[model samples]
Structure formats: C-alpha cells, structure tokens
Target: MSRTAVYNLPARWLHWAIFGLIALEFAIAWTMPDIHRDTRPVGLVAWHLGLGTFILSLMLLRLLWRGVSGVPDPHPGPAWQDRIARLTHALLYAGFIALPLLGWANASARGWTVHWAGWVPLPALAAHGAAWARPLGDVHQIVAYALLGLIALHVLAAAHHHFIVRDGVLRRMWSSSR
Candidate 1:
C-alpha cells in the first residue's frame, strides 16, 4: 500500500462513522414501534428520529468534506467496473441524503416535530397533515431497502477486489496508512 492508494484520514473516518451510524439506525428502526398517525415520538421512535437527523447531518458534513478533500484516484480496473463503482457510490450518497429528508417529510405530515440530535429543531419539510408527503414514508422504506442492496453489492465488490482481483480497493478505505 502507498499513501496515494488509500483515502485521506478524514474521508476514511467520515466514511466509517456514517457506516456505523446507518447500521445502528437500521437496528433501531427494526425494533421501533410502527409509526401511526397518532403515535407520539417516544422510546425507539424518538431514537430513530434523532439518529436519522444525526445521520443526515453527518452525511452533509461528509459531502462537504469530500468536496474539500477530494478522493484518491480509483484503483486500476476494468472501465465497466469503474463505471459501476461510480454509479453505486453516487446512489449510496444520494440514498443517505434522501432517507432522512423523506422521513422528515413524512414526520411533518404526521405532525411530528423532528429535532437534530434531540436538540436543534429542524424545520418541517411539509405542512401538517400534508397528503403529498405521507407517501414519502413508503418511499423512504423502499429506498432504504434498495440502498441496503447497493451496500451489499459494494461490500461484495470490495471483497472481489481484495481476493479475486488482488487489488487494493478494499484497503483504500479499510486502512489509514500504507
């Protein structure tokens, strides 16, 4: 490994942080009581909302940091593989940003006041009882499932790079140093 082969420290840090947070979000979502019109943000629902907000904030920060720090050059690979990798990464980023916003809109439609990290109040994305945004909850869940598939593809690709291709692609983010 060489310095140029891996992501910068901050990029790697943000990447793993978001990964861990999203994993936690999924776990909380699975155990949380189902959201209903009259449901109050308590217990796991509160945790889910707060964590979603935090994930959104972190994604934004990660995007900003990525813009500032850029990224390491892509490991040498087939052009098609590179294209797929790029598309997958783009969708992952979009999914991360969209999930929370969709949930926020859905929450607003349900008249829930979402807060960032359980403190800073976030503005409602939709008016209370707005029908248009209500469907977004379903969309949010669908996109989440799709994103999970994408993540699986991503991890498998990384493994392929490490074992089959014998490239440093996986190591690019897994390790901080050469």
Candidate 2:
C-alpha cells in the first residue's frame, strides 16, 4: 500500500491530545502547592500526579501507534534540515517519556505514592527519605526546563515551515489530508 501524505486521524488526535495534556501538566505543576513528605497532597498536587500518570500512558500509546502505523513521508528539505527535524522529534519523544519517569522516580524517592486518577495506586521506585530524592528532583527540574525549550523550538520550526517556507510540512501533521 502507498504511504499517505498526511498523518491519519488517530495520529492527529493523539498528537493534539498529548499536547494539551502536557500543557495541563505544566499548569498544574506551576499552580499546585509544593508537595513534601510532611504535607498531604490535596488540590492541584493530586491533579498533577494523576494527570502525569495519564500523560505517561498516553505517551506510551502514542509511541506504540506510531510504531504500528508509521509516519508520513518526510517533507522535501535539505538533508541538514531534515536531520535537525528528526533530532527535534526524537528529543520531544524522549522528553515525553523521560519527564514523567523522572517525576515518578522523584516521588518514589520522597516516599510519595502516585495514584492514577486517585484510584489505582502505583508502586514507589524508592523508599521514603531516600537520599536520591533531592538529586532526582533537581534533575527533573532541569529536564523539564530543557523540554520546554525544545518544545519552543519545535513550534517555531513548524511555524517557519507553514508561514515562511510554505513547504506543507506543518500541514502534514496539522491537517487531515492524505
């Protein structure tokens, strides 16, 4: 079968849905009270943890879907540009996976339980008061900042393709056309 020129409907939905979830994750994290071992998680902190688990699950599903369905053909561009694009996409996927795992590890190290929608409880990777908690939290923060930068770059590149380059690269993922 011939490869399509644009992403399939499921792919598009997954892309946008994940995007929204990531935004919500950031919003929750920023607005929520600081969660420490002594403090009980209530409002936004609980939402953050639950939403984070959901995002991780969605990321896994997105990766699986991409692997099974494959992606549209690369847009016509210089080899260097294409390589950069591929690298950017790789980093974004890595960030999606790494950020959540890092948060989970941090929570585990701090003796915090992460629940899925406050119903299903996830096991902690480390014991409470683990020495690694602080360091892991630091790493998580660093990675989160870097991921935000990468996202900005990705958005600017897509806008450049759509507006300046007019190459239809952005349209492939944005529109529902084959």
lDDT of each: 0.90, 0.84
Q: List CA RMSD, all candidates.
A: 2.1, 1.4
TM-score of 2: 0.94
lDDT score for candidate 2 against the true structure:
0.84
In order of appearance, the predictions have TM-scores of 0.95, 0.94
Looking at model 2, residue 66 earns an lDDT score of: 95
Model 2 Cα lDDT, one tens digit per residue, 7-73: 8888899999999988988988888887665766567877887888888888889899999999987
